[model samples]
Target: MNDDMTHEPSDTTGPRRLTRTRDGRMITGVCSGAAAYFNVDPTLVRIGAAVVTILTSGAGILLYAAAVLLIPEEGKDVSIAQELINKQTSRN
Candidate 1:
């Protein structure tokens, strides 16, 4: 005899960053951030970044690093003020 299991899956979803790899907030270490976000090997991003740096003469690298530092962490746990801002953004 076997017992039947009849349980509905609970919803465990919420807004996540556009890039699970957190592309937006990654510092110039875009490769690293991309790797983390997309759950891909960082080596791929590293190789890509290296190629871009060589082709673009470090401009890409510089920009990537700048972005990492400037970008906010994804899934930033909402604070009271941030929630208010979100509400305002939604209204208009």
Candidate 2:
């Protein structure tokens, strides 16, 4: 008697999400991004960001949300910022 088994390779894909980080100062994607990048809890980064924002009287809240709308979701294969654009460009 003989037995054989085959398995397909697993796919490698990074999670894509809007970051609230200082990259653009729009929101608090920094923490989320960091968590994904370094495998850390995003809450820690958020707390750190909050502590820093204390000096500014919670100005970071507005900035964090703004970042959510600004930053683009990460791509599956390639990890890079797609960027947010307002006006559509004319195709040449």
Per lDDT, the best of the predicted structures is 1
Q: Estimate each model's TM-score.
A: 0.46, 0.43
Note the Cα lDDT for every prediction shown.
0.52, 0.48
Residue 16, model 2: lDDT of 37
**Candidate 2, residues 2-72: lDDT per residue as tens digits?**
22221111223644343333332334355566554554555666687788689779887776655555554
Q: 27-89, model 1: which lDDT tens digit per residue?
A: 334454456555556677677877888999889768665555444444445434456778999
> After superposition, which runs of candidate 2 have C-alpha atoms over 4 Å from their true positions?
1-30, 75-92
lDDT of 2: 0.48
Worst 10 residues of 2 by lDDT: 1-10
